[model samples]
Target: MKTVVITGAASGMGLSATKLFLAKGWKVMMADFNQEAGKKTADELATRYSKKQVAFHKTNVADSSSVKELKNATAKFFGVADSIINNAGIFTKGALHEVSEENWDRIMAVDVKSIYLMTKYFVPDMIKQKAGTIVNTASISGLTGDYNMAAYNAAKGAVVNLVRAMA
Candidate 1:
């Protein structure tokens, strides 16, 4: 069966995507920083689908070693991924001047650098395999600016352009 690694799989669209992929007969590796949510959701999904087809890994997508561990988990569970969904992101709402440097960095790390890190760690295998797909979950905010959402806008905007560059 085909396989997918979906970041942020603990909730929201990421969770939806995981269910959809599984229903479509794909093995899914659910990656999220929320260990409790991730494990619980994975266990629930396992009851509905084959347990072997779903695995959860606590991940800090912005960290290199954590991403490396994710890569290892992917290979250990499902081999080289057929697809990767870069859906993990965090939003900090504030005007640029009001946003804290820490908040800005967190947003950028999760929304932007995670994709870069995932690509850095995962793309080589995809390239060697000669067939793979990457789906980045960039928002409408990535396309248009939002009031009082400068950091998210900037971060997501970078995601939009980064996907374009990858394409």
Candidate 2:
């Protein structure tokens, strides 16, 4: 069976995708920073689908070591990944002048660096296998600026361009 690895798989779009993929008969490796949510989602999926088709790995995509471990774990669990969805992100809202450096860095780390880290580790495996797909989730806020969300908008804009660069 084909396997798909989805980051941020504990909630929102990532979680929804996990369910859809399982329903369609794909082995899904759910990666999320929230261990409780990730484990819960995995258990729920396993119960609904079957234990053989779902697995969960606690992952914090902003950290390089964590992303590397996630890649290794997924490879060990499923042999290879046919696709990856980089969907982990965090948003911070404030005026550009009012945004603290800490908040800026945090947003950039989660919303932008996470994608880079995931690609750094996973793309090599994908290339070696000679077949793979990657999907990155970016918001309209990234495409068009929004009030009081300068930092988030900038980070997500970076994501949009990064996806284009990867493509």
Candidate 3:
């Protein structure tokens, strides 16, 4: 069976993707920053499927060490991943000049750096196997300038280009 590793698997698009994959009979490692929510989602999926089909590991995708731990846990539980969904990201809203440095950093770390971290640890194994897919979620904001989401637009734009370059 194919196995997928998804960051931000506790909610939103990530959660929806998890359900779809499980329904298709794929094993999934759900990595999310919120431990309680991640575990709860995994538990519910586990019941609907099987315990072995779902696993949750609390992860801070912005941090290299945390991402490495997530990679290791996935390897231990489900072997090499066939796909990685870099779905963990944050949104920030402000005028270009009004965006604080801290908020800019936070948005970049979660939305852009997390993709780099995930790829750093997972891509080599994918190469070794001669197969794998990496999906980085981006928004329409990445395609056009927005009034109040400068940081979000910039970060997501980076992700769009990064994925294209990777391809």
* Model 1, span 52-165: residue lDDT tens: 899999999999999999999999988999999999999888789999999999999999999999999899999999999999989999999899999999999999999989
Model 1 is weakest, by summed lDDT over 10 consecutive residues, at: 87-96
Candidate 3, residue 18: CA error in Å? 0.2
Name the runs in model 2 displaced over 4 angstroms.
none
Per-residue lDDT tens digits for candidate 3, residues 7-125, read 99999999999999999999999999999999998999999999999999999999999999999999999999999999988998999899999999999999999999999999999
Q: Which of the two, 1 or 2, has more TM-score?
A: 1
Evaluate all candidate structures by whole-model CA lDDT and list the values in order.
0.95, 0.91, 0.95
Clashing pairs in 1: none
Clashing pairs in 2: none
TM-score for candidate 1, please give it: 0.98
lDDT of 2 by residue, 112-164 (tens): 99988888888887899899999998999889999999998999899899988
What's every prediction's RMSD, in angstroms? 0.6, 0.9, 0.6
